[model samples]
Target chain A: MRKLLPYPILSLSLLVLWLLLQQSLAIGQILLGAVIAVLAARAFAALEPQQPRARKLGSIFKLAALVIVDVMRSNLAVASIVLRDRHRQQTAGFVVMPLTLRDRSGLAILACIITATPGSAWLEYDSVRGTVLIHVLDLVDEATWVDTIKNRYERLLLEIFQ
Target chain B: MSEVPVWVAALVGGLSILGAAFTLLGCIGLARFNSFYARVHAPTLGTSLGSIAILLASAIYFTVSAQRPAVHEVLILVFISITTPVTLMLLARAALYRDRAESSGDVPLQWGEDIVVERADAPSEG
Candidate 1:
C-alpha cells in the first residue's frame, strides 16, 4: 500500500485540488486527475524525505481553530495600530524565544502562524540553538508574546507532531 | 451579473470591497513604515484577511448562483494560505542576508546560516 502511494495525504489532496480547479467530476477528469496526483506523489517521493507522523489527529483541528481566532484578533489589533497607534508610545521590536518543538513540520507550521498574523513576523529560527527570532509591530509585552508562542502554539504542536 | 439579486450582489460587492481595502491597508503599511524589516509585514494583511474575504465572497457568489457548490475559490484560498508565508519567509531571509552583508547594525550578524559553532575559548569577544 505504501509502495503504490508513498504519500497518501499528498496524493489525495493533489487529486482534490485538481478536481476543484477543473470544477468538474466527469469520468475522464477523474482519470486524468488520478494520474496527475499519482505522478506528483511519485515525483515528491523521489526526494526521499522524512515522513512526519501526526501522532494526534484531533489536536490538529484544535490547533487550526486556535490559529484562525488568533489571526482574526491580530488582524484587528494590527490594523488599529497601523491606523491610529503609530504616534503613541507603542514599540516595535524583536523577540528571541527558545523553542522545544523539534519537528520540521511543526516548525514550519509555527513559522506560518507567526508570519500570517498581521503584527508578528518570523525573522529567523536557529535549529542548533533552538531559538526563533520574531518581530512585532506593536510590541507591548515581550514575555506575553513569548509565553503565547510557547504555550498556545508550541505546546499543541508538540502534542500533534511528536 | 445582471441576473443576480440585489442582496447577493451587495454581499459579493461588499466582501470584494472589504478585501480590497484590507489589501490597500497592507500596502499603506509598506509605505508608512520606515525600515525594510518593518515593511515586511505589509503583505500579511493582504494575504490573510484580504484573500480570505475575497475568496469567501467568490465562493458564496458562485455557489448561490450556479447552484452547484462552487469550491474553486477554495483552491485559491488554500494556495494563498500555503504560499504566502513561504514567500514571506524567503523574502525575509533574503532581505536580512542582503542587509547584513552591507554590515548594517539592524540585523544580527550570525543569522540565516545554519550551525552556530560554539567553543570554550574560541574568541568570545565581539
Candidate 2:
C-alpha cells in the first residue's frame, strides 16, 4: 500500500479534484482519475517537499470560520472607506509585528489569511527576526492590527500546525 | 431553465448583483487609492467575497436547473482563494523592492530596520 500510494491524502484529494473537473462518476473516468492521481502523487513525492504536520481538526475549522467572518467584515469596511471616506484623510501605513508561529505551513497560511482579507496585505517576512511586514489600508491603530493578527489568527494557526 | 423556482432565481440574481457591486467597488478602490501598497488591497474585495458570491450563485443555479449537485464551482473558489494570496504577495513584495531600490522614503528601510516613514496622519504616540 505504501509503495502504491506514497501520499494517500494527496492522491485522494487529487482524485476527487479530477472527478470534480470531469463532473462524472463513470467507471472509466474513475479508473482514469485514479491512474492520474497516483501518477501525480508520485511526481510530487519526487520533489521531496517538506511534509507539514497539521493537527487539531477542530482548530482548523474554527480558524476557517473566523477567516470567513473577518474577510466579509473587512470587505464592507474597505468598501465604505473607499466610497464614503474618500475625501477624508486616510492613514494607510505598514505594520511590523513579531510572530511566534514558526512552522512553515503556519506562516504560509497566515500569509494567505492576511492577503485575502481586504484592507490588509502581507508584504514580507523576516525569518531571522521572526517578524512580518503587512500593509493596512485603514491604519487606525497599529497595536490593534498587531493584536488582531497575533491573537486572532496566529494563535489558532499555532494550535493547528505547531 | 425557465422552470427554476422564483426563490432560486431571486437568490441567484441577488448574489450576482452583490458580487458585481463588490467587484465594481474593488475597481474603484484600485483607481482611487494613491499608493501601490494601498492599491494592492483593493482587488482582494473582488477576489474574496466577490468571487465566492458569484461562484455560489453559479453552483446553486446549476444545481437547481440540472437537478443535480453542481459543486464544481467550489474548485474554482478553492483555487482562487489559494492563488490570489500568492500573486498579491508577490506583487506587493516586488513593489516594495522597487520602492526600496529607488530609495523612496515612503516604505521602511529594510526587513529588520525600524525606520518607519512618519506621516502627518500617523497616530501620535502616547
Worst 10 residues of 2 chain A by lDDT: A81-90
> Which segments of model 1 are wrong by more than 4 Å?
B111-126
**TM-score: model 2, chain A:** 0.96
Q: List the residue pairs that clash in candidate 1.
A: none
Give the TM-score (vs. native) of candidate 2.
0.93
Residue A131, candidate 2: alpha-carbon lDDT: 90
lDDT of 1 by residue, A48-151 (tens): 99888887878899999999999888877767666864566247788888999999989999999899888888988888889988988878899999998899
TM-score of each: 0.91, 0.93
> Weakest 10 consecutive residues, lDDT, candidate 1 chain A?
A81-90
> B1-126 in candidate 2: lDDT tens per residue?
558999999999999999999999999999998888889999999998899899999999999999999999999999999999999999999988998989885888784344344544466854
Candidate 2 CAPRI category: medium
